[model samples]
Target: MSILAEEQIERFFNVLNQSSEIIQKSKDQSYLDSLIEVLDTVQSGDVQALNLAKADTTAVSDIYATFNRDDYDSEVLRKAIQMAVLKAIKVDKIQANYQITPDTIANVVGYLIAGIFNGHRQLSLLDPAMGTGNLLTAVANQLSNSIGVKLSVSGIENDDAMFELAASSFELQHIHAELFHEDTIQNVLAPMVDVALSDLPVGYYPIDANTKGYNTRSTTGHSYVHHLMIEFAMNHVNKGGFGFFLVPSQIFKTSEAKQLLKWMQGHVYLQGLLNLPTELFSNKASQKAIMILQNTGGGAKQAKQIMLGEFPSFKDQTAFQKFLTEIDDWQRNDLLQ
Candidate 1:
């Protein structure tokens, strides 16, 4: 069924029951105004523009209320969206797959979400993290209406969540999800956390001071693992390719994060940094950084970072658009140009 069909209606209702924004859109006229902008963009004779209007604004509002529930925070919802899309695929068609994975989804969304903000094109292929893909499913749901080709996908998620979810999602829809059950974290502890420990490991918010590092520390399991995400993105991406990776925010200022960021800044073109607010994982949101890196050029002289404020009404996408419009042009011109 189409994402905009009965399933979507049921999903929206599901959100209405759980999300804070269920009844807030009416009260938030600016958000409604953003919807008007989206409608205007869609009616401007560009199908992709319309898709962008929906994807960036309207669809997001719905997703925020539904898929982005507290239980489905960033990482989990990232997984759930992947799982939902996997369930959306056809079983037999799994044989003819795009090989998308959780990592791939993380990478691609990281890139696209940020890239779309900068108004970029020409990013055609993606190499998903190579294992059964919960992340890829999220990407599929995220890009359901976009007219772009999934050239190739490589993914890895060492647990059954990867395989079981990927397989089921594939059977539900026609989308191809190339999945694997390999441990994508290299140079790190194998299966670092307990399978049951899927929630946001407390104290992940980006604070100037140390909050409370639950499962985090400067260990192999801590920082080196993300290096793999960076190395993979820096290496596997086709020249001039852009990749989005769900890397930790510490990589921006922390000494450990520096290794990867330094390599990224020196080797690949450094785009903007989206400093997502805290507790995104508080319920359905997780405070995570979406690293939009590119292999198009050899890093930036200085990375441009943007701090995003709070948007309690995730359904009110107009606030986000307002935020985007509010983003200083001088700050964005570095990469957006």
Candidate 2:
């Protein structure tokens, strides 16, 4: 019932295009601010839209000013606002620190989450580096499409621009989420969940030498920043919860990373690994892998052999569709049995 018709979707894009034309003529204001202001006005349904329109600061008013509100579809406008933020981030007008996941990869991740927990009526999902909320948003959308309600999402993002964009987008889409705008490692997260998903940031954050979880060998010798983020996320999972992380492939080859992996194996079930394409990200040239883990609750019998696979170029629609089908079949058989 919440799905939009094809015509409505087209109209939304048309509205976005017309709004862009208007913003292009206004030199003093930015599309981001105007779009955000319009979204705020739509969600709040107050006089801010008119106030921004009346202010003689630019050639045009706020994005909602020109629209005839009597017949305007608020849903379309909300979606346009959400898409505009993602578009801005995509064009590099916003600094994402080159951490955003590709749309296709995000879809694959979403599909895996949906399939793995197909029978679950409620889920809690977390993303440690949730840039613009795309990955979680994608998974939420997938789940809603399958079961007609969104998941409970808690995410952490250190970047201010990304945090605002993600928060606004989640609000616009009516997705249930609690987002933390701080460094994930420095911040304490106590909520346990059914799923954890992240595309970890590639750099290091300064750690206190005396901190408990700190390992000087891993931190100084080889930048185990991803390791720390993974551990933090892992701690916030329920007994049978699962985690999926997009990490550098070095975790499988380096000695420090091997130590981290061994430690994780002792605590949780190391389910499998999916090696992603080297060219999946446009901004960074690094080989990436998807590490899949399940919380074993420290049971000795819970450890199992890990299944390994490689994802074909996710950009190829046919291959992705096939991969999704295979995952669905596997999840159905494995999970049901």
Candidate 3:
């Protein structure tokens, strides 16, 4: 980030914190909830927060006034919101799945998606598990700025706090997205999108009845939610549309791999699986890889040589650039062909 961007983010973030704290204390709500109210106040330029809390209207207005949305670009505003959400997560002690997708991973996803769909004048995207709209907005901003593609974005979040946070963040960034607050597995009414992306939440899905028609549903136990989510996400993708998922590195080595493999056959072409840098995780088991898939139709076929490899540490600038160059070559020579 440039010095100006950094200054903008810090300034905006301080205003968010101050306003959220006032709301939290007055309303007896969690920081996350109060933060959402503050965000809504900033976006609407109305102190609807005054209705929810006993905060002094003048004090709240003064803090909200300091955030002039025009001063920061979408990316800078997003990072500032991300910092506030991270702090809220810490204060609220939310579950692991609520964690924001790191910027490094979001940027990589954006790079891959932009490369794959570069020539399109427009695109539609879906995130089956948008935690707080961070990843979706990051990719949207990249596509718009890099290639000037008009985008239609949609996301689903089951948790109330997350759903509201995403809604607020999307509005604040002026990212027009269709958002649903329903369980993705049970709700399959999503629009058929051109590309589907997710940092798949890890765990076993508890509702077996809803898993009745899913190919990844377990035979003897609750199915892995991540497995079911991938299947669910792909089902909403247009023919030959692509999916980019951040999944556990050992995704295919587990007991549920057979069911997942069965689903992959004839349904989608497994195009690539690139292990993220291991240093990004705290342990081997927590490491993840980006899995690329293309629905099997509209001229989509397996790549001549699947793009597979481990990314060098991002700190190794030369090696990282070489890896990206190789990806560009593969896109031209294999996938696009």
Q: CA lDDT, every prediction?
A: 0.40, 0.65, 0.91
For residues 288-333, write the lDDT of model 2, one tens digit per residue. 7788788876332332345467777766779867876766665655
- C-alpha displacement of 332 in model 3, angstroms? 1.0
Tens-digit lDDT string for candidate 1 (57-147): 4543544433422222233333433433333233213432323333532443533444343343322333334334445545544444353
Q: Of the candidates numbered 2 and 3, which has the greater TM-score value?
A: 3
TM-score of predicted structure 3: 0.97
Q: Which candidate, 2 or 3, has the higher lDDT?
A: 3
Q: What lDDT would candidate 2 get against the real structure? A: 0.65
Instruction: Please give the lDDT score for candidate 3.
Output: 0.91
TM for every model, in the order presented, reads 0.49, 0.78, 0.97
lDDT of 3 at 307: 91
Which stretches of candidate 3 lie above 4 Å from their native place? 52-55
Inter-residue clash pairs, candidate 2: none
For every candidate in turn, the CA RMSD to the true structure comes to 16.6, 4.5, 1.3
